[model samples]
Target: VKSQHSERCIDFLTKELKVSNEKQAQERVLFVSARETLQAR
Candidate 1:
């Protein structure tokens, strides 16, 4: 039972990490685009 609980925890953590990583990637893309636009001006 304890092992099962740990497994679930790990799964949840992995999912959370994936979500955060995706968010960071999106933000980085946005930042780069904004910088490019500013430099173009």
Candidate 2:
């Protein structure tokens, strides 16, 4: 169940952000999260 949700998130990120590969997707996730964290401060 959790894995399925994760897959969906990855797919959504790939489409929304136009990341071409899994490694890029992971990096994009990190970048987005870091921006969100700074914004939350």
Candidate 3:
């Protein structure tokens, strides 16, 4: 039972990490595009 609980915790943490990474990637894309737009003006 203890092992099973730890496995679930690890899984949850991995999922949370993946979500944060995706958010960071999205923010980077947005920043790059905004910079490009500013340069174009």
User: Could you give the C-alpha RMSD of every candidate to the true structure, in order shown?
Assistant: 14.7, 6.0, 14.9
State the lDDT of candidate 2 residue by residue for 1-41, as single tens digits.
Answer: 54565566677877776656666665544323556679999
Model 3 misplacement above 4 A? 16-41
For model 3, what is the C-alpha lDDT against the true structure?
A: 0.48
Off by over 4 Å in 1: 16-41
Worst 10 residues of 1 by lDDT: 23-32
TM-score of 1: 0.36
Candidate with the larger lDDT of 1 and 2: 2
Candidate 2, residue 35: Cα displacement in angstroms equals 28
Residue 22, candidate 1: Cα error in Å is 17
Per-residue lDDT tens digits for candidate 3, residues 1-41, read 54565455455545655544434444333212556679999
Candidate 2 regions with alpha-carbon error over 4 angstroms: 24-41
How many pairs of residues collide in each model? 0, 0, 0
Backbone steric clashes in candidate 3, count:
0
